[model samples]
Target: MSRAKRKIEHIHHALEHDRDYYNHFDDIDIVHQSLAKLNFDELSLSVEAGELKLSSPLFINAMTGGGGERTEQINGEIALAASETGIGMAVGSQMSALKDPAERNSYEIVRKNNPDGIIFANVGSEASVSQANEAIEMIEADGLQIHVNTLQELIMPEGDRNFKTRMENIQRIVEGVSQPVIVKEVGFGMSKESVECLWNLGVRYVDIGGRGGTNFSKVENLRREKPFSSFENWGIPTPISVLEAKSIHKDLHIIASGGIRHGVDGVKAMVLGGEAFGMAGTLLRVLLQDGRQALISEVEHILHEVKMALMLMNARSTKELHRQPYVLSGKTREWQEQRM
Candidate 1:
């Protein structure tokens, strides 16, 4: 099948699948405070990342693009939702658009819809300076997310073979591009070492796209001649990945993802070290199944739930949530200890 056809298939499989290794959520807990002096309306979660000033810490993450009519329609709907909600959003890999100019409108629809909201342009880690620049220009991107998907590529039958140029590509992009380049994981999660490397390379933003979200291994395996079932459950949990990234650098802005299905997970992610939370699967489901109005309602509900979580802990902001006392247990804690 063509890559564009494969892209749509990937989305279908992601929606109808459940391949999470275990309950990573079981590993994280935020201590609730008995007293909260402020009202829910007083919660100020204004997140300033790169040049984007979001109303809240939640953003619709990168997914779907580079196909024909159906892909564009999906992106258009997702963009409209983002525009209405006033949250940051990202378009999936623009490589298809770059290669085939006909697909540009599919990704560009995001910018056309969300003119003012924070929109991130995305590309693989192997993208050159020109490709990255073109992607950002294509969307008038507020920021650029260079996703590292080594494991996903390994599972993909037609994926790139030589993967040694990622660091060099990232370094060049960061140095050459005026927009802030964020190094992100494609669901496998980011490690301390990798985060530290990005920090040293002048890349200030990182998205720890941990496991427990969409399983790309499963998505890709279904397309291959033979499935690699054993690798399906690979990678660190989302919260653990956030802890690991935070351990490497205090100043790097961390965006948490990977199985962040609801507001409660977003709250826990903030406590664990996420400055901003990105929800892909859950938000996608809501938008696709229930339509735009329902998607808006769901986002509003999720944000409200996150605010309640903040009030429960008396966290006036996500920064405060990060400072709040929290405990890690179960397999997450054990893995953390072993890593230490």
Candidate 2:
């Protein structure tokens, strides 16, 4: 099948399926302070990564692209939300656009809609440095996100078999691109070991696309003749992965994703060391089910909740939000206890 058709199929499956099992955000808590001296209106957040800054940390991460006009329209609506909110936006894998010039408009719609917002161009790890650069230029991206999905690819009949040179490939892209290169897991989470590997490769930004939000293993299983249900519940939860990334290195800017269902979850991620939180599945569902206004409403609702959490934590800024106290419990605690 063509990339556009395949992209549409993936979106359909994600939209219709019940892929969530354990989010693990419930395993961590951003302890509240009743004596919070800060007011909600005073809470100003700018996620800092070294010298890089996001005026607003809330963002819509890429989940679909290059699936023809339908995908393009979906992207346009999401980009409209991002542009309206002043948060960053990421376009899904531009590989289809790279292979077929006809599909270029599908990805380019994001740039056309959100002309001034911080936009991220996303690609698979298999892409070469030149290919990565092209993906960036296609959308005039602010940064490039290189997604690693070994299991997702393995399950798909048309997916890649070679992950051997991914590290070297990432290093090349980070060196070749003028924009910052961010390595992200595709709903499989990132461990301290993985973060260390990327850090050693000179990649400073990592998005822990943890399990529990969208399970590609389960999604792909539905596409197969006989599903591999055993692998469905794989990978570390989002909160645990954030904890693991926090333990690895303080300088490694972390972007927490996967199963971040609401703004409260976003707040929990920050306390666990996420510089910013990404919501793909929830945002996509809202847009598809209720249209553009509903999507904007959802984003505003989450941002409001984040402000409330900040007020409760007495955090005056995103930097101070991370300094507030939090604790891990339940299975997430067990997971960390074994590793720590």
Candidate 3:
């Protein structure tokens, strides 16, 4: 199938197969402060994720683009929502656009709609330095995200099998690109070793795209002639991934993604040492099912809830979330103990 058709199919399967699986954020509980001096109105949501400063810690993670007009509309809507909400947005992989100039507009619509918003360009880890630069230039992105999806590629019949050079490619991209390079996972969360490797390669930002959100393995299985349901529940959970990334280094910026459902989950991620939290499946579902306005309202509601969570935690800003007390219990704590 063509890349455009595959892109649409991926979206369709993702929306149809969307499930409310547990992401382990529930395993985290922030200890409440009764005599907190901080007022609710005084809490600030502003956060710095590496060099990029965001008005809110929440961002619209990498989703769709480069399919066709449908994808262009989706990207535009998402960009507008992100702009309206004062959050960052990352376009889906731009390899299709880089390969075909006609598809460039699909991804370009993101920057066209939200010209001043913090936009991120994305490509798979296989992309060469020139190709990565082309993707960044195509969208005028503030940063570039090189996503690694070994399990997803293995499940997808048409996906690439050669991933040996992904690390080398990422290192080259980091050195070649002037913008910040973010090494991201696609539903298969990063290990501490993976985080350390990226950190050693001069990568400062890492988006631990953990499981519990959109399962690309399941999506690919649905497209396969012979389905593999066994691989659907693979990879580390979002909360666990956050812990793993943080365990590597305190200076390493972690963008907690995967199955972040709401603002509470976002707050939990920050408290666990994530610089910011990203939502792709949740925001994409809202945009598709409800409409652009609904998506905007959803983002606003999430941002409001983040502020409320900070107020309840006796924190003045997202940076202060680490100073607040939190308890990790259940499977998440076990994972932390074993892994970290």
Structural RMSD, model 3: 1.1
Q: Each prediction's Cα RMSD?
A: 1.2, 1.1, 1.1
Q: Which regions in candidate 3 have their CA more than 4 angstroms from the true location?
A: 18-20
Badly placed stretches (over 4 Å) of model 1 are 50-52
lDDT of 1 at 278: 93
TM per prediction: 0.97, 0.98, 0.98
Q: Which lDDT tens digits does candidate 1 get at residues 1-340? A: 6868988998898898885757687778888889778889888878876565678899999998987888898889888888887778888999889888998989988888878888999999888999999999999998899999988888888888798878888999999999887888988998888888888888889999999989999888888888998999888779889989989867788999999878998888888888899988888888789888898888888888988998998878877887888888889899889985
State residue 169's C-alpha deviation in candidate 3, in Å. 0.6
Q: Write the per-residue lDDT of candidate 3 for residues 15-130, one digit (tens) a residue.
A: 88956456588899899877777878878999876688889899999999889999999999998998888899999999999888999999998889998999999999999999
Instruction: Report clash pairs, candidate 2.
Output: 4-67
Badly placed stretches (over 4 Å) of model 2 are none
TM-score of model 3 vs. true structure: 0.98
Q: Which ten-residue region of model 3 has the weakest summed lDDT? A: 15-24
